[model samples]
Target: MRTTTIPVAAAAAILALTLAGCSGGGDDTTGGAGARTPAPPTSAPVTSAAPTPSASSTGGRASAHTEAELTGVFQRIQFRPAEFTTTDAMLDSVYPGLTVSDASCLAPFGVGWDTSDDAGTVVFGTSNDRSMTAVVASTGETAAATDLVEDARSALTRCADGSALFSMQGKPIETTVETAEPSLTGTDEAIGWRVRGTVGGNAFTLVGHTARVGGDVVALVGWDPTSNTTNVPLATQMFVDAL
Candidate 1:
């Protein structure tokens, strides 16, 4: 077992804000067990853009995915339309250290969807215990998306050693990251990892899955304060098919 420290204030802020899911809705259609169909590339050519550290906007080059297209990707994963919401501020807070430069071929944008309850922010579908947040981006160069996935894999591996620590407000929050080989197949590349830790005496487990399809990369993070298990593989496959 390894331990890492992470700042819980900023990270926990996003995790603590528990929003309810919409009610009276049925489950969305799920993909079949057969081979997955890869998502197509952006219609427009990707242009070069400089990375800017702005919480309110995606400073990198714009993705071909419109707000609707991005939302559609999540919807294919069984999330209702109403549950999907923009999360620029949350992304800025959690991944401040992740660089998003044109040179790096990584341009990240994210959305948050509520799986449980329905009275909080944006309501979508029914209330349950599972909630998911995803960051999808475009990589201009060939194999760039694969490189991004590997980078995340490496970072998670380091954190699993129990040596990573982040400061939350002024308190020391201990952290740990665990990863496993995914059983799902058919994607160009994919990886899954689990993070468990305590912030201000509150325990949380975050499950994440990252996969590359064509020139795009999708990173899904699911969290539940009470459980460490998540259906990330199913969600990841759905995302791939939706692409």
Candidate 2:
């Protein structure tokens, strides 16, 4: 998909670049699901600043949720937090769905591409190139949510060593993805992964996560220019908690 780099902007902070949760613990990827870490903070979270909602979240959005409902979720995220951006900007300032260089990898990475009657999408961003894309959708008899989460984890794990993920402005990005383990509890199932590489030669890191909260599947993705400061464990914890 047109996996271009997200539009540049700024915010208080972006998503967690570390394996540690917001409590600032450790980045352990080898542990089992039961071996979770601490919880992240709840304020000034991912894509914190209010971003203009996209069409899929508005007229094209599912359920056509009321303004009040939207505001409440926004408030939760603002007070809460993650990081990453794709052009449609969540799944980097990249897309409502991600367009990848290799077509086979599309389904798992393109988190927001599914705009079924059961789903609604919204993207959040700030002034400093920070962003998070969230999608809330219902599961069906076909086990949509379960498949989605599982497939994403599988795809990320397969691509962990590095591959051509997408192209931005014709620049191919060879990304090395590492799965993340968030400490926040309360969800039937969860999946997360972070991407590291350069876009047009500018280093960047992005993280995305999804969980099954009852019948609804919620997903969040974050992106930021890679920096020594971006790997803060506390922010990563804070970012995962909001999910």
Candidate 3:
């Protein structure tokens, strides 16, 4: 894993959504029979939402992207004049090989990197192995904190590594991904699941909590990784509850 320095001004970026946040697998390359594609491990077939569209599908907007989406932007979202903050040790704990060159940035997301620096209102940080990098804002950061919580709920709706997941509201829309009948099920059916992933070659887990946040439907978008594939119930609550 190689490490490198990322500039502050160049590192800051404002994603479409309003808040902050932060998966994994082995290198087994065995294929299934004559096919080169490795057969997915037969983990017990965990049933959650069957993958169906929620009530929000009726021309409704999402409150925000789920945790998975926000986490997906860990390396993609950066804030100018870095404002929010996190410690180096915290980051290292989450991402083993993280290194910070700025020393003036902070990771507003619940997770952090090995090295972090703050520059004015802007924050900067990089993974130890340099596989990921990100920056966030501390200005008006508290206001976005609520948005962050909502994102977390959305994350659960999409994928919870440990606990079972189901929608808490509307029925999950069914969609075909490969040969699997993965349905998006109702929000009432989408809940639970552990959050797990890797950063800088280290394993990390995030679980618990379905925080409520204030933000419009437009405020939350493109925040979770599972958005494209599944709907997040918690996120829907935040969006609908947003004032």
Candidate 3 Cα misplacement greater than 4 A, ranges: 1-89, 94-109, 112-143, 159-206, 210-243
User: What local distance difference test score does each model get?
Assistant: 0.42, 0.42, 0.26
lDDT of 3: 0.26
Name the regions of candidate 2 deviating beyond 4 angstroms. Answer: 1-71, 79-99, 102-110, 117-130, 140-142, 225-243
Model 2's C-alpha root-mean-square deviation from the true structure amounts to: 13.6
| Per-residue lDDT of 225 in model 1 | 40
lDDT of 2 by residue, 8-59 (tens): 1322233322321333222322232224345554333444333222212112
Judge candidate 2 at residue 174 and give its lDDT.
71
Candidate 3, residue 161: CA error in Å?
Answer: 5.2
Q: What lDDT is reached at residue 239 by model 3?
A: 23
Tell me the TM-score of each prediction against the true structure: 0.52, 0.51, 0.20
Model 2 lDDT-worst window of ten: 53-62
- The per-prediction CA RMSD against the true structure, in angstroms, equals 15.9, 13.6, 20.4
Error of 2 at 39 (Å): 30
